[model samples]
Target: MSLTEILSNFHISETTEEIYKNTIKASEIETPIGKLIAVADDNFLYILIKLKSPDKVINTFNILQKELSSSIVIGSTKIITQLENELTEYFSGKLKSFTIPMRCLGTDFRQQSWNQLKKIAYGETMSYGELAVKLGRNVNHARAVGSAAGANPIIILVPCHRLTAQNGHLGGFSCGIDVKTWLLQHESKFKNK
Candidate 1:
C-alpha cells in the first residue's frame, strides 16, 4: 500500500518541520500477545514493546514525526508495529532481538556494514576488528568499518551497538553511547532467553 494509505488507516497525520518533511502515525490495539503501540516515521517504524505492562512505554513516534518535514514517506508493513511492541518489551527488560525489516539508504560499503551488523546475535558483541575481518579487510580497517556502521540510520534494527572496540570498550555511536549502552544491556538481559 502507499504511505498515505497506510498512514490514513492508522489515523496518522503528515506535517513539515524545519529539518525534514515527515509523517507520523500510531495505533493502540489489543492483541492475543498483549496491547501494543505502533509508531512510524517517514523512513522507519518502531514498536513500543513492553515486559510486564504496556503502560510504561510512551509513544514517541508522533513526537519525532512532528519534528520532521512532510516530504518523507513511510514504508508499509506490520513490522514497525511489531517492532514497537518488541522495543517496549525490550526497554522494560523483556525482549532481545527485533524481527523488523528495515530499509537504509547508503553507499555500497555502508550497506555492507549495516548488513553485517544484523548478523550480530542478541546479547552478543563484536569488536570493530572482528567486523572488519568479517568483511575480509585488514584489522586496521576496523576504524573505517566502524565509521560506516556509525552512519547507519536504522540504529537498533541494524544492531550497531553490537560493534565495539577491540578491547571490548564502548565506542562512538551516532545515536550516543548512552543509547548504545541501553541497547547492549537490553540485549544482554535476553541472552539466554
Candidate 2:
C-alpha cells in the first residue's frame, strides 16, 4: 500500500499512541475534606478538582486529554509536589496565597473573570455584581461572572469560593456548596493569623 493509503487508515487511538506523546502527570492528593485529583506538568498545574466518583474521574481525564493532546498518566511531578505542599499549608491556614503557576483554559471572558477571583483577599468576599464591575461590565453582567466562576477548575487555589451573593449567601462552587462553605469558614478562621 502507498503511504497515502496507509495514512488514510490511521485511527485516532493509533495516532494518539504515536504522535501526541506529551505526558501529563496526575496524582490523587488527600485533603481534610476529600481527595483531590491534580493534573500538572513541569510548567503549569492544570486541573485540580475535588474527587467525586469513578465515572467523574474518567470523564475529567477524557476532556482534559483531548484538549491537551497528551496522555494523562498516574505519576508525580515537581509541580504536583509543590501543589501538595501548598495545599497542606493552605488547609491549616498558614498559607494565604498560592504562588504555584497555573494554566487556566477557557474563553476570554472566563479568563478575565477567573483572574479577578485571584485578587479576592483570603477572608474577604466579593459579590458577583462587584466582580462584574471590576471586569468593566454593568451589574447585569453578574450572572455571566457567576458562570465563569463556576467553571474555574483549580478549586481552592483559584479561590472562587470567596465570592458571595449580595445578600450574604455563598454562591455556587464546582465542588459543592458544603465544600464552599467549609473553605470560606476555614479562610475566615485564619485570615487574621
Candidate 3:
C-alpha cells in the first residue's frame, strides 16, 4: 500500500513533510506481544510497527524506500539495536522511559501531537480531550488528536496507546485493541516495580 492508503487506513489525510533521506535499515524483532518491523538509519529511528497487517506494512517498507529516496535492506542499525534493547526492558517492566532518538516524519500537527504523546508517562494514560488541551486546542480537537494518534507510526515507543476516548474507552489502536489492552495492563501491573 502507498503512504496515502496507509494513512487512509488510519482514517487520516496525508500531508507532505520534509524528511532526511538515507539507506533505511530494517529488521523484525520479537516481543511478548508480537513481532515488530523496525526501520531506521544511522541518525534516527524512522518507523516501527507490529506485523498486524503484514502485507500492508511490509509494502510500507517498499513505499518508504521510494518516498524516502532510500533503499530498505533486511538488516539493523545501531538505533534499531538500541530500540530492541529498550523494548525488551520495557516489556520486562524495568524501563520507564525510552532513550532512543526517534524522528517524526509527518505533518506539523502530527509531529506536535506525537511530541505530546511522548510526554505521557509510562503506565499513565489520559483522554484525547486532555491531550488536545495540552496541545493548546480545546476539547473539540480531541477527535483530530485521536486521528493523529491513530496514525502514529512508531506505536509503543510513541505511546499513542495512552490516549483514550472521552468516556475512558480503549477506543482504537493500530495494533488492535487487544494489544492496547495488554500494554495498559502490563504497565499497570508493573508501574511501581
Q: Best by lDDT, which number?
A: 2
Candidate 1 segments exceeding 4 Å error: 1-70, 73-79
Off by over 4 Å in 3: 1-21, 55-63
Could you give candidate 1's per-residue lDDT for residues 35-76 as a string of tens digits? 434445534554332212222232233333444433223443
lDDT of 2 at 24: 87
Enumerate residue pairs that collide in model 3. Answer: none
- Alpha carbon lDDT of each predicted model: 0.61, 0.83, 0.81
| TM-score for each predicted model, relative to the true structure | 0.61, 0.88, 0.85
lDDT of 2 by residue, 1-193 (tens): 3222322342347657686779888788989878888889999998888765445555556666778887766788999999999999999889998999998778899999999999999998999999999999998898999999877778888889988888889878778899988888898899999
Candidate 1: how large is its RMSD? 9.4
Error of 2 at 94 (Å): 0.7
Poorest stretch of ten by lDDT in candidate 2: 1-10
- Clash count, candidate 3: 0
Better of 1 and 2 by TM-score: 2
Candidate ranking under TM-score, highest first, comes to 2, 3, 1
TM-score, structure 2 vs. true = 0.88
